[model samples]
Every structure is written in structure tokens, then in C-alpha cells.
Target: MTTDRISRQDARRNAIIQAARACFRDKGLHGTSMADIAREAQLGPGQIYRCFQNKDAIVEAIIKVIISARVEHMLAVNHDLVRKADEFTRSLAGIAAFDSRDDALLLEISAEATRNPRIAQLVVEADLNLFEQGCAMLKARYPHLDTIQVNALSEVMAVLTEGTLLRRHVRPHRPIDAQCLQSNYLAILHTLFPDTQSNNTRKKD
Candidate 1:
């Protein structure tokens, strides 16, 4: 295809994905239809169809966008996490705000995944990909950790992240103290990594 045609296709795909996210957030997966997405995108149903085979394709695209964002954040972390422990811990605690539109959309998709086998598979695959990426980051930063430890740490982080996301839905109005959040994350980091010098000093003082 010509360059202009490719650009138009890309633009349409993005519009469809953005529209799908909003619809899924508002009406959920099963409730949202192609017509709804078309209206949201301000495009005809045929145009949306030209970009994606079905709603599932748009959902998959949305998952990819989420993965890209998360992986980019992971990549931005310093390799020497021990030395940057305070900074890293604070970054983790910053997630406590839980005001992300993407988080809401993911929660909706996760709920739908439990009942839809195809969606469950896609979610599982995306989760595994994220897990592997996280593990790779951990291994690079802490080469002394064995594979089991690295995997366990990655799983713990995943649990913490998902749990925080769940809390966002259950208690959206709850206010979390940033200082307390940082302290709690610091404790978790110290416990998991087991530094005898700096972490212990901070814990004591």
C-alpha cells in the first residue's frame, strides 16, 4: 500500500483502540458494541472493520498498548536498584494514587477474561510477557539472585501492582498518605532484597 494509505490505516486503528478503551471502561466488554465504538471514534462501522477484524482485535491492540507503556516504565529503572533504593521505593509508592484510566480499563478486561476463554488466553499471554520482562529487569539489576528468587520477586511485584489496582476500584475515594506509602514500600524492598548496610541503617534510623 502507499505511505498515505498506511498512515490512514494506523490512524484508524488508534482511533478504534482509543474508542474501544472508553467504551469498555463505560459499558464493559460485552456491553460495548461495534456500533458504540464506531460512534465513539466518529468513524463508520465499515471503517472500523477495515482496521480490525472484530472487537477482540481492538481489545488485543489495547493490551499491546498497555504492555508497551509498562515495559517502557520498567526499562527506565536504573540497573543499580540497591543504590537507588530510595528513589525506586518512592516510585513504587507513587502508584498509590490509582487515578489511571488504563487501570480502570484493565480491571474491566480482567473481569471479562474470567468468563471468556479467548480473552482469558490473551490476558494470560500478556501477563506472562510482562512477568518475563520484569524478571529480566530484576536479573540484570541483581545477578546474585537465583532464578527462583528472581521469579518470586517478580511475582510479588505483580501481586502488589494488581492488588493496588483492585483497591482503586473498591475504594476509589480512600486517601493514602504518601509518606506512609513510601515507608511501606521501603520495608517491602528491604525485606525482599536483604541489604545489610544501607537498608538496615535506614530501617533502624
Candidate 2:
């Protein structure tokens, strides 16, 4: 009897998680309700509430899922990316696109943070952690760039990318795209490290 109860509970929990992810993506964090999640999961509202105390809990869970997916994708960077800045940019940009669900939740989370101090704290911490990771990557590839320079560049990239994403998503027909972004970033890189240009590097093939 105990084993059967645990199995049922696990199933219900997984169902809610899966459903919440879909509902959150389809409906922004504010737009989604517990009832919507229940319908998505084919469960009753009580089932969602039983597993998650409230709508905030569901949003937190969805963000966690999306965050985990992003972290994993970021970890998959190719160390052999020294000769290929464009490839590295694509991999870095891919961290956000691990799933379309990520972009949806991130935009909503940004909005939520503006209204809630606790949520704002989470966003700050998460962005810092992610920026640190990006800085580490920069260190690995371009050890010549000092810590201060790395942090500065990472901050610039983070803000620019976020703004670009917001514009792209909210205005899908917008002229901005990742290629344009890469070109702009490369220009920055060229100015920042003129010494590292392809002509300066004997390794360029």
C-alpha cells in the first residue's frame, strides 16, 4: 500500500510539472492560472494545488526547469572554439534557446522581478551566476583578457542580448537577429582585442 501511494504521488508530481511547463510557455507567468495547468495536465485544480501550494510555486518550478535546461546547455561549450568566435557566439546564444519555453519564462520573470523584491533577488542572483559562467568561458578562450575586462564585456553582452531578445520576441518582424548581433559583438571584440585579430593570429586558416 505504501509503495502504491508513493508511485501515485510521483506520477501526479511529474504530471503537474510537465503541464505547468506547457501552460507557462503558452500563457505568460501572469496569464497562466492553476486551472489552466490542471487542464493541460488532465488533472483537477486540487491536484495542482496539492502538489504546489500556489501559483507562485508553480512559476518557481517552471523557472527552475528552464534554468536547469539553460545551465546544462551552457556547459556543453566546445573548448576547441578558439579559432571560431562565431561558433562560440552561437553556442552561447543557444543557452537561452535550449527550449522556446525558456524565452517565455525569462521575459515573464523579468517582469515579475520588477514587482516582487524576492523574485527580483532571484533574478539578480541568477544573472550574476550566469554572467560569472560567461566570464569564465572568456577566461578559458582568451586568457589574455583580464578579470576587469572580462566582467565588463560580459555585462555589455548580457544587457545587449537581453534587450535584443525582448525586441525580437515582442516584435517578431523586427530587423534585429542573432547574425546582426554576432557582427556587432565581433566588432566590439575587434576593438577590445585588436591584437587578437585574425591577421595577428598565425593560427587563422
Candidate 3:
């Protein structure tokens, strides 16, 4: 009820979420238990239950954190891309810097979503939110593009980005060549927006 009490509750909840994320990343969803999370959070089982009803609740919270962070990153990247088409290759490379553990956790979540209705719904909602935001950014930046084209391009971009993340898990030992990724992304950009490419060339000339 008091401000301090609310702050404490918020802090405890966040601590539990962080612990759940780490546990899930290491042991995966099925492998992890509420007891594991409690140990990781340095809290008693009863204390953790005070904040979250069950392991599923903690898992959902972790997913929310991941989605929120990703949406923010996508929005930032979208803003940069709209303002600086010439720097699109650099931006692509920036987004490609993947963390192995995070990628693994994402793969785990994807697999779990196949059987977990709640997680499936959460993933669907997060994806639609991301797609809408991406579409808005693309529509604003390239008003000449028709609605269908904008939607298609946004879907392609999302697929490409997710594919890159998936690759990290598929080939954990492989080194990512930044230049190669940039070149590929630039080619995709040129194919998608040839007019912008020509305009950039003319500006440089």
C-alpha cells in the first residue's frame, strides 16, 4: 500500500523474473522448476510464490521482458533506417550480433509454444505488435509503397531477422562475417528499394 512497500514488491518481482530467465536459459522451460528459480533468486519457495503463482507465471514474465526489449530495439533500428538508408548495412550488422544463450532460450521458447497455449498466445501477440510497429515505420519511410508491398516487405524483414537469430543456435561455432552480412543486407535493400539506391548513388556523385 505504501510507496516503499510497492517499490519492494516491484524489486522482488523483477529479481524473480531475472532468476527465471537465467534458469530457463540454462536449463530450458521443462528442465527448470520453481524451486530452481527460487534458489537462483536467493529467495524461499514461499517468497517466490508470493510474487508469482507458478513457474508458468515466471516464464510468462520472462517472455514479456524479452518481447519488450526486442520491440524497443526494433523501433530504434527502424528510426535509424528511415533516417539513414545509406547506413542500412551497418544497422543490419548491428542487429546480427547474437548472444548464444539468448538464442538458445528463444529456440526453447519456440518449441514450448507449440504445446503451451498460453505461450503460443503470448508469442502471437508479441509478433503482431512487432509487425504493426514495423509496418508503420516502413509506410512512413516509403510512402510510395502500396499497402500490400509494405506488408510483404515487413514480413520479409521479420523472417530474415528471425532466421539470423535461428542461425546462431544452428551453428554456434561459426563466425559471423560482418562484411558479408552487410553486403547481403545491402543487396536486399537495393532489391526492395531500387529508387532509393539510385538516389543515394546520385547524391554521392
Candidate 4:
């Protein structure tokens, strides 16, 4: 493409991506259409084509935004929680403020991946990185758990975190109460740091 044409094309592609994000936020992946995104982005249908080939291409962009946003969010952590009490409190607050819309879209995309073998592999590879991060966190806290054991625990934490967050949306009134969520997470954390718990108990005595 010519310089002017390429610049215009790049600008249009950005507009469509921005529009797709807003459309997905408002109407979800299944509900939104390419036309709707084009309208929101203020680009013509033809303009959208010069950028993304299809609606799936746009949906894939949305998925990347959802996953990358949170994955990057996690990497921002740099703190010293001197006690399980502090760590548990942080965990509860973190989970409580998580975006339910993003979670729902991610879950839907994950389910969709199952039908498309290619997408399934990509999704699994992406999630495996998150799992590895969780395992690393647990390993730092509880050095005794071997790699295999830490991996198992990390997977449990992943499942539990997602389950409770979903419950927060599905049953608003019965959402994991802050204390209950902390206590439950603490119970698991204690498994990783029995010495911390024991020392705290002794201090109390």
C-alpha cells in the first residue's frame, strides 16, 4: 500500500478496535455485529473490511484486550504482606473489585475455543501462563510444596477464585462475603505456610 493509504488504513484499524471494545462492553460478543462496531467506530463497513477481515477477527481482538488487561494488572503487584492476615485481606479486595463483564466474556470465549481446535490450543497456552504465575506466588509463600504439589494448589486457587467471582455476579446477595472469602483463602494459604500460622498462634498465646 502507498504511504498515505497505509497511514489511513492504520488509523481506520485503530478506530475499529476501539469501537469493537465499546460494542463488546455494551452488547457482548454475540450481540454485537461488525456493522454495529463500524457505526460506533465511525467508520464505514468497507473501511472495517480494509482493516479486519471478519467479525471473528474483531472478536479475537476483544478477547486479547480482556486477557491482556488482567494479565498486565497482575504483573503490577510489588508489595510485602508481612502476614497471612494482610495477604488474605488483599486477596479478598482484589477478587471483589474484579470486572465481571470481562470475566463473562473471557469464559464465553474459552467455551467457544473448545469447538475450534486451533483456538482451543491458543486459549490453553494463554491460560497456562496465568497458572504458572499462580504457582510461582504460592511457591514463594510455601517453599515446602514441591513443583507438582504447588501446581495442583495453584490450579485449585484458579478454580476457586473464578467460581467465587462468578457467584458474586450470579447471586449478588450471596456474593462471597469479604470475611468469608478471606478466611477460606487463608485456610488454603495456611497449607503453604504452616509455620506462619503456628507462629501467629504462639504469638497470640
Candidate 5:
């Protein structure tokens, strides 16, 4: 394909993905259809098909985009560890960064993955990618830590993130204090990265 054609196709695919996200947020994955996405995107159904073979393909693309975003966020956090270590701990405590709608979509997709082999494959692959990238970040920040330690720390981080999201969704009424949450998470971070925490304290002093 020509460069112009590829660019147009890419743009078209992005528009469709954005539209599908809106539809999914409003009507959910199973509730939304190709026609609804087309209407939202202001594109024809044929255009949507040309960009994506079906809704599954579109979901895969959306997941890819979310993963890409998360990778970028991880890189940013890694950078903060080097330059603004104290801020990194505070960032961990701030739960507002995660969008509930996005979490819902991920949970919905995960539920679908149980029944759909293709989606299950995508979830497995995306998770592995995230975990590996997370390990790399930890290794970079705490080079003194061995492979096993870094791997364990990465798993802890993943659990903390996903578990926090689940708790917020499942128990929205049971609100936790912001100060208490920050203090507790800071203690966990200090325990996990003692060297960084000491460095952060020294900088503060």
C-alpha cells in the first residue's frame, strides 16, 4: 500500500477504536455493535469492516492501545524513580490516576477471555508483556536486587495495582482515607526499595 493509503487507514482505525471505547463505556462490549460504532465514528459500516474484521479485532486493538499506554506510564514512573524518587511514592498512593471505566472494560474483556480462546491469548500475551516490562523497571531502579527479588517485587506491584482497582469497584461505599492510604503505601514502598527510600529521605533532609 502507498504511504498515504497506510496513513489514512491508520487514522481510520484510530477513529473506530475511539468510537468503540465510547460505545463500550456506555453500552458495554456485548451490547455495542459495529453499526453503533460506525454511527459514533461518523463512518460507514464498510469503513469499519475495512479497518477491523470484526468486533473481536477491534477489542484486540483497544487492548493493544491500553497496553501501549501502560508501558509508557511505566517508563515515566521509572524515570521518576531516578529523578524524583519521593514523588514516585506519592504517585503510587494516588488512586485517582486509574479510570474506573477503563478498569470495567478490562474486567469485561477478562470475563470474555474465559470463553474465547483468542481473547484469552491476547490477555495472556498482554499481561506477560506488562510483567516483563515491570521487572525491567524494577531491575533498573534496584540493580542490587537479584533476579528473583526483582521478579517478586514486580508481582507485588501488579497485585497492588489490580487489587486496588478491584476493591474500589467492589466496595465503592467503603472509602479509605487518602492520608492513611498514602502513609501505608509509602511504608510498603520503603520496605520493597529500601535503598531508594533512604535516598529519598536523604534528599528530603
Candidate 6:
């Protein structure tokens, strides 16, 4: 009930989530157990259970953290891209370079979502949050576009970004060319905003 106690509780909960993420990345969702997470966090099962009722609760918390971070990043990138389209392409390239562990963890969560009703609901809620934030960013940038157009554009962007993440996990060995990534992103931007010019202007020799 005290502030210090609440802070400690939150810290412990976050530690559990981090441990669960690492364990999930290495052993996968089905392979991971609450005992594995407890060992990874260096905490006893009692402590973990004090914070989360079960592994599913921990998984839901992890999904919330991951999705919240992603939504924040996407909102920031969208704001910058409105000012300069080059930022958009650069953001995609940055995503293309995420750590393999992150790819694995996300893929694992996605796979689990398909079979688990609770995880499926969490994923759907997270996705809706993302879509709403994306829609707001688009509306702010392109006020001229109607609601339908903005929604469609946001959906396209989300699909493309998610696809990029999936591709990295599914084909870890395939090298993504920075130039091609940028070019493809630019093409998408150009299609969406035909009047806007990308800041990148390297003349082809």
C-alpha cells in the first residue's frame, strides 16, 4: 500500500517479465515453464506467483510491454516522417536490423496467440491500440485525407511493418539490403502521398 512497497512490487514484476521474455526467446512459449522463468529471474516461485497468478499473466504483461513500446516508437516515427519522408525509410531500415532474439520472442508470442484464447485476445487488443495510434498520427499529418483513406493507409503501413518483422524471423539468414528497403519504403510513401517528395535524393549514376 505504501509508495515504496508499490515500487518494489512493480520492479519485481518487471524483472519477472524480462526473465520470461528471455526464456521464451530461448525455449519458446510451449517449451517455457513458470519454473524456468522463476530460475531466470533469480526469484522463488512464491515471489513470481505473488506478482503474477500464472505464466499466462506474465505472457500478457510481456505482450503489453512490447506492444506499448512499439506503439510509442511508431507514433514518434510517424510524427517525424510527416516532416521528412526520409525518416520513414530510415525507420524501416532500423527495424530490419533488430536483434534476432527480439524476432524470436515476437514470433513466439504471435504463434502462441493463434492457439491460446487469452493470448489471442491480448494480441487483438494490442493491435487495436496500435491501429488507433497510427490512425491519429496519419490524421494529424494528412488532414486533407478522409477517414476511410486514412484508415486504409494506416492498415497498409501496419501490414508492411509487421510483414518486415515476420520476414526477419522466418528468414534470418537472408540479408536485407538497406538500399532496397529504403527504395521500397519510398515507393509506398510516394503512392500514399504523390505530392510529397522524399528527402533522399541520390542521383543514379
| Colliding pairs, model 3 | none
- Model 1 stretches astray by more than 4 angstroms: 79-99, 172-176, 195-205
* Tens digit per residue, CA lDDT, model 1, 178-197: 66665666677667766545
Q: What are the clash counts of all predictions, listed in order? A: 0, 0, 0, 0, 0, 0
Error of 4 at 45 (Å): 2.2
RMSD per prediction, one decimal? 4.6, 5.1, 4.1, 5.3, 4.3, 5.5
lDDT per residue for candidate 2 within 159-202, as digits (tens), equals: 75565556445654434366776776677656654557456567
- Judged by TM-score relative to the true structure, which candidate is superior, 2 or 4? 2
Q: Residue pairs in steric clash, candidate 1?
A: none
Give one digit per residue, the lDDT tens place, for model 6 in 94-117.
543235566568778889998899
Q: Give the local distance difference test score of model 3.
A: 0.75
Best by TM-score: 1
Compute each candidate's TM-score over C-alphas: 0.84, 0.68, 0.82, 0.67, 0.83, 0.83
Q: How far does residue 120 in candidate 1 sit from its true spot (Å)? A: 0.4
Give the per-residue Cα lDDT of candidate 4 at 4: 100
Question: What are the Cα lDDT values of the candidates?
Answer: 0.78, 0.69, 0.75, 0.66, 0.79, 0.76
10 residues in a row with least lDDT, candidate 1: 90-99
Residue-wise C-alpha lDDT for candidate 5, range 23-131, written one tens digit per residue: 9888877788999999999999999998899999999999999889888877876634332334333344444454557778898888878888888999999999999
Candidate 3 vs. true structure, TM-score: 0.82
Candidate 6 backbone collisions, by pair = none
Model 1 lDDT at residue 63: 94
